[model samples]
Target: MAISITQFASDSNLLNTPLWDKQSEILEEFWAGNYAIAVWALGRRSGKTLMSAIVATYCATMLADEYKRHLRPGEKFYIISVANTIDQAKIALQGVKDLINGSPILKPLIVRETTDTLELRNGAVFRALTASSRSGRGMACPLLIFDELAHAVDTEAGNAAGSSLYQALSPSVAQFGKIGKILLLSSPWIQSGIFWDLYKQAASGNFAHMQVVQAPTWEVNTTISAEFLEQEKARDPELFKVEYGAQFTGNIAAFIDNQLVDAAINSDRGLLPPLNKFNGTYYLALDPAKGGRDAYTACIVHYDGELVVVDQFHQFAPTWGDGKKTQVAVSLVEDWILEQHKAYGFASVVLDQYNSSSTIQRLSGRVKIRELTWTASSKTEAYSKLRELFNGGSIELYPHPKANGQIKNLTVTYRPNGTWGVSGGTGAAVDDYPSALAGAVLMATNRINKQQIIPAKSYRTW
Candidate 1:
């Protein structure tokens, strides 16, 4: 007995021949299970596109055949592949074409076109589409593959055409006996977006998900040496993580040392000591800007043995009218602090007093609000102090997921004048959050009584 093309391809010999890594195993399992959705997250140059194309090609040819055999002729079986742009779509399809060309048996069944589609002899089609919301309209597809879905724009006019396209294709897939399969592949970009939501859902076991593969630069190929990665880390650690770590860290280029920031994050345990026991008091730091693209960022910190950032609030305002919205924001901050104080009693609130005098004055009467002066020289000093605290493990962050998003936006840089400036990137402005945190540490650890409280307990004792 001779095996068919589909059978041969499905055999372990053929499937495992092309360097079957962990991602391939997951994809094969997902396909075999007829999963409704599968997300593949790989770092740069992990051959994600190639793997995606292979899956799409298999669905277009082998899976479509299986689907048609279980139904009548003239039934629709479509493989719709999309990417952030037309060029990216082309690149994805190119990998499909390469896969087909490399396989002697599969090459004969594929009809390649310059536009980047593979029309199988079995009447199944593999068409490359752009991520434009318009692209998915009025088309029925059984299989949907979205490459780099994170970068797709979600228009404000309530017109998510790209997303809508996928929704539209659902019925067509459901018409078949099997559940529709949607494969979303991308590197991390923005922290909060449609893609992030989908990824989270998949990760949380909300869906029948396969695996999330993180192919860092080191894992991609030998060309990306550790020395090169170290160089990139030296240049800007946040950028290196974003570029190579497959971390969707929003622009944090302006902070002093991103490596230090990354190191500060506690991956093992998110717990911190009780706020009241560590510091006798707590303070809220505010960096105010007139309502514009940048809004005021407020950070609330508690001083324990070190400075601990308890919470952060940020809002954007594009005009003076928006700035007027600060009252509502201020009220929210007050409520937050009151809640925190109730949880762990705090001493007072410290704020940058220049622009927010009125706001400060308004809050001071209710809760203790002290104004902290920001000198040009102190900016560097404060940033250095923060680094020291972070490295020394004196600071603890709230384990809220939002804190990760905030941290991703922080960057560090040294000024030409031998000073350092920590800035926020990716639609974030003002160093208020870090500043407040640093202020809390300063106030807590600063020797006011000329005495230090040493912990009687040690790690060995614990």
Candidate 2:
């Protein structure tokens, strides 16, 4: 029989330090062949990538023959480390590379290496790739590590879909029977997706062949201090709960119905242009970026009597400076808005008065500025109006995947201060698009209300 994972690491000198107690237990349990599936809902900075790398290295080296026996004569055995994106997958791949480089025994086994793949002399192949159902098909995989599985959204579908990828890949491990293992590791997210489904099954004590481990960062990584966790919680309690406490936030909930958002999208239309006759009014709405986390967003919308059309959507990305300071050029954003105004001649420019004083001052003489003082009541009203438009099927959006995804991914939290904290999901998810869309829809609704109230203006186009 092949040596245990811990023994393989020791013989090869693969790890710089010994595995933590929980990490050792995880490997030990997996090696005991009690489970075909292992789910790790760990907190951030819990050394998930390093642990996954160790598993991959051991499978590629020690368990090579056992896995290959079921394969065809020349068919390669695959060990895949896939994540939400290629860059994230590469972190785990790099860890494996570092281990092999540090080990005299394992280093010689690498017959070939590339940026995203490793091939051993014994015909074992290791690959790092982005999540896709098409990519995972027909491979003879004995070990598959799905890193950050909670965040694995279907980029191709332009919606939150992970089940298809899971269904496609999970079956590839069937040939090896008990020897085949699929490991999923991620920080806890919303109570959805395949990861959550498996976690629930494991927790229910119904799936005897599935093992699940859940632990906070502080519990798993002893070096993380209480003071640091305290600071993180003070900064953003909901996010800290998910990122460090390993808790699925019960407070944060999906804001918009995804089916409603999907119904509002016009897939065939891509950024409609302004009308040539200029008979109707155009509204320009802006959501300025506060910092690096968000993109500066603007939307140009046209509301006829029956339909609301988003003519254009603009997003300005930030440039990173030293120490990772992000600088989004306000002047560039101003210029783009002015260009849109030159084309559409917007009747009213709507924007929140938060972090936009300078922009307002610059456009004071150029356009009609309708400033929204974003109090708790104002935000609730705006988002509610946007949701109303979506549910009514009166608004149409173009095929912008990121913007559409943002709208679908938005979540609402009722805070202790009696305010609705509306946001996109944590960690790289932003609400800039949704914010601008809300502003535009709010303005459109007000225009319709105003037209109805004034008898004389009822006939006029707006």
TM-score, per-candidate, Cα-based: 0.51, 0.59
Ten residues in sequence with the least summed lDDT for candidate 2: 452-461
Off by over 4 Å in 1: 1-17, 69-72, 154-165, 209-224, 248-254, 258-462
Worst lDDT 10-window in candidate 1: 453-462
Tens digits of per-residue lDDT, candidate 2, 202-242, equal 88888889888999998888887889988676544556778
For model 2, state the Cα shift of residue 458 in Å: 38
Candidate 1 local accuracy as lDDT?
0.57
- State the lDDT of candidate 1 residue by residue for 1-462, as single tens digits: 143333444555333225334544566566566567776666666666866776776666656656676455775566778876679888888877776767766677765556856777777777787766454544556677888766665445222443555565545556555545678777666555556667777788756643444556566554557787776665445545655687764422445344455665656655444444544455545555544334555555554443455544434333235443432345555566566556645555555655656656566555655565666655555565565555555566654454444455566643211134566554534444555565554444443334321211111110
Q: CA lDDT, every prediction? A: 0.57, 0.78
